[model samples]
Target: MKEMQGELATRALPDLVRDLHAAEATGTLEIEMQGQRRKLHFVRGEIYLPAATPLARRLAALLAEEHSDGHELTALVQRMVDLTSSWREGSYRFLESKDDSGGELVGPLPTLEFARLGGASTSPEAAEAPTESRPSAPPGPPATDPLAKLGGERARWITVPKRSGSFDPAEQWVLEQLRQPRTLRDLLEDSPVPRAELLETAAKLAAAGYLRSLDRPRVETGAFEFQSETLQRLRLRIASFLEEKPLDGDLESQRSRVMELLATREDLDHYQLLGIGPFASTDEVQRAYEEMARLVHPLRAEELGLAESAGALTELFDSMTTAYLTLSDNERRRDYDRQHGLGPEAATVTETSPTAARQEEREELARSYFERAMAYEARAEIHFAIEMLTLATATDPTHAEYFLNLGRLQARNPNWLRRAATSYLRGISLSPREIPPRLELARILEKLGELPRARVQYHTILRIDSTHQVALARRQELEERIAAENRGEGGLLGRFFRKG
Candidate 1:
């Protein structure tokens, strides 16, 4: 074959360049434009293609053009750059080639293999052995936004990035798909990998701790149990509060009833919560407040690090304070009683006296009309207050302070427990559905040793709110009492007096 070279041969040189490169032919190559020619030299593995125009020649030419300096070379080079970019994408033949004879022939030589022109031996083994190319994966189902497919329940999955290691790719895929509660089966359905093989691989990965365990998240029984324990503690506090006050013979029993009512519930009404029957003295109310406050006060919870229990602490404090406050005020108590129909009017006082004796009694009553009043004048019912103050004065007349206050104020002070118990009982009478008074009556009943009444109250409270504080506390106290008895704290008398 004749190899072409030089100006006449330059026209045919473009097509034969591929053949020369593949064949590893070495020689100088040249081309001409208009009447001028440029030579590019090649020696062994080295190539030298020199610039025909000076650097910055066109940029300078543009500046000169503004000044009307005529220079066509810059435009020509720019045209060549643009042409090269376009021709490379299309088919372009090497227009020069050289033979060992170094002849300047102009005719066309044979066509060259474009594919092998830039081929560098990848491996000696590849050259020796012809291996079959593996079939490529079918293009993935038209690319779609992965995020758009996640729907609403998307927080469950987390994105993980590519990493190193042989198992990394498989790990990443599993992690990406492992939404909580979504089993391996669901994950496999969405994956591109074959199910059987993927499952086998997934199992292996799980065994190696590279995949999540198949076990479902366990319910936290501890938290539920903790709540139950807290309720029990509240009941004990209520019990302790009542024990400090010795109520009227049956009042203790009534207080027990209230404790019983509150035993099983977490939230309790204030009036019924103490379990004291209506008409508790101010002293008893104060005592109950103190006892409960001691147990449930937010300040007390500092030891438990309750500061972290932001919500629970606030709720507990509010509930305890509210219960105490509601049962402590007389007017509120009376209103509550009136609403429940537990007014003192409901209790009938029997009279047994003849007309002459009754006439004498009226004469004496007229002389001391202030002896039995039920209203405080300072609070808008002077006559009622005077009547109560009169009686109080008669009882403790030696105290000048008592007499003056009674005469002036109509001392109609009601006992805290009495008012609370009255209110609670009224609540029960009015709304048998309500739980607080029932719980309170139960506690008071328990304190008075009326176990049956207390039990009924506790049962009722539980029926309404299973987690009543007094009820739970009483249960815990009873359990502890039992344990103490086992340890001989109550002794022989305790056993003998034990309720069946």
Candidate 2:
């Protein structure tokens, strides 16, 4: 059969999967939505592999452990299924296949099991369910070795609503000791009950959401306190860098001094530029950008009449902007980290070859030009801004942001529309996954009366990010207008034929 596809809004995902399972379908189900993609593979109704985010993958891996008793896996799978069922927007397609030999087999998750897992009655009911009906022995913890670590905080029982029944004797004893924070080791050493029984009871309670594990309290050297101190020191360093005595020279000499200051700075890496630590979250990067923008943005510099040092200040601001652009994007950041040897598996290169040194020098020079362009742009000197930006791109064609800025500047004039399109295309070619340049290019195409081409660009973007609201709206509007125009032309032709 041809591939079956539909939007999530029109069809419930769980029901669709259930239908497929009933048919004993063997294929891959691909989901695209909300700027992310996921895949579920089946071999004759059994899920062979599920590709998703790191957290989901890790959860799945845990559930796949050979030694895990069935109970833990069931609980984990139930949680996973519940989470997956919540997604409301997306498109899914299932492609049928006859052979599925290579993928890792996960489950032939039955419809009955899926329903049972998703059912509200899975948890014990206080009024109707018997206390003795609950597991006499606690189920094993999900695929992980629960007994591995100790000496942290003990697990405490969460308060439940008053019920007629009480926990069994062993569970009661465990809960009483857990009232105060004590490690597994402490509990094992002191408990009157057997070690196996106590551990099992604790695991079950935790899984049932009756118990929660707390972290051991630390002294003055807590991670949060250290981070705050580090941020304060970073602020001081930036202030010191920005605070330079008035130079004794003309405009040209001051400009030279500004360039010198920018080039000689020892801290310009992506993390340092953003005032963040390594592997910072996108949210953290955005917060740092906003904070730094208030301090070193060109508009702020202009308001302060720092014209003499505009070039230097602009460069500093652009460096932060570049940092934000790179770090905010998942793909670009990974590539950036890999190129600069900043990633986890970065290898040591003891010897710096001549080519590498030259490359570094070229990059520094390119940045200098880029910074000067930003300075000119801030002053409303459009001609000078374009010139400097052009030189920057010539010096470093690989820098996607340089091309993007150039394209934006070029796009202002009607006469230079083609050039703007070319520049945006170049930027897109350099960093295909970057969305801003593509969005700009689509708008440019639409303005140039290339609606078909613009639609193609918008569609491409939707493929990348299904939930891109702007693109979706624009595409829909364009389609409606086109349809209306076609109907109008058809009516006019019919009227003319009748007149003849």
Candidate 3:
């Protein structure tokens, strides 16, 4: 079968379809021509049928309506061969719904009426139009693969070119579903747009060649019986609707919402605004902001290792920063508080931007750097600790704990006292209620011989925390020194006057 040529070779359909089914390929199997879409069905290595998707009909209507380019079926078949060379995985990522770009491709396939060579027996006539006015497919069996039941049905198919723009949204959505399979009907029900429009759009997209159905998935029924057989068949058909369609209203609306939500803030701290037990300080906030910005920033999309996902990452960062800034601000924090009926300190809602929701990702990376720096500090490797702390701060400055930790390390190192003081101050600015910063600052002042200032700082600490034993002791010692100095001065003045 692999050894054939011309039309036979150009059409790898029968063999490719069989292999795909054999492997239980889970994603879309798109076949494109110069610009048309073709639908294929497979089940456990069996090539059951070939059909035209609803999207193809929509595309044909569009071509007729716009007087745009029409398609030749043979050329489309050839183009499909050309495309096959690029499929290392032999499948494309699945989409939950048609997108504007994908939908646009479903313009239409040229309907061909064949004329017999001898002018005998059969007469040429236009193909019969469907009885159903709406562009729709029959409800197939409830198998996991939606197209499994429609085998042996010969139907027209079309293909279209890939749309120029970002596929980030489509890619993300597909990946989200890879973790959990969904049906076309489920997709429609979840969409924000009208179901008919969404379906029509998906059909058009399928015709354009951006979407395709999946093969019937193999179900691992118990030891004796295969269960979900029907479900597996239905899933393939459902997969088709998704592959052929652009994103529906729900997906589009959600994407827009994420973008809008992203646009409103600059820092990622709904958690901090809620005051959920104080994991970080101002320094931590700055560190976290920069780190997140690096990951989400449109500019660093390539540099920070999101080259393929540059667009999505950029948009994600934009939303994250916006969210962060909104939550970071006191006034905005209050507004959010009132709206959500939450206190100044509360746990953050899990639902936010998709990008921001990846906290586990951030935390995992964050914890690694934090723990490494702490380990270095524990070993008294001050320089290494400083470097690690610097990286940690850069990655997640919003964590006040990092700043305090860094400052403490600096304070211990003889050569880093000045830097230590700076870090401590930053920590203080972020969290004024913390005692470490206040104590560290007073100690630094005392070390620098700023006795007056040190005493004042100690007094301030006493005011805030009256039971502070260290501050009380320091204040008492400073007072005694002042009294002793006054007595010595008085004695010296009296002796000088007597000698004179």
> How do the residues 355-448 of candidate 1 rate in per-residue lDDT, one tens digit apiece?
3123333334323333323324446766444434433332222233333344223212332333333334434644567655466556555555
Better of 1 and 2 by lDDT: 2
Sorting all predicted structures by lDDT, with the top scorer first, yields 2, 3, 1
TM-scores for candidates 1 onward, in order: 0.19, 0.28, 0.28
How does each model score on lDDT? 0.40, 0.57, 0.43
Q: How much does candidate 1 score in TM-score?
A: 0.19
Tens digit of lDDT per residue, candidate 3, span 107-173?
A: 2122111111111112112112221321222232344332222211122111111223244444334
Candidate with the larger lDDT of 2 and 3 = 2
Instruction: Give the candidate number with the greatest TM-score.
Output: 2
Total clashing residue pairs per candidate?
85, 0, 78
RMSD of 1: 36.7
lDDT of 3: 0.43
Candidate 1: list runs displaced more than 4 Å: 1-267, 302-310, 341-500
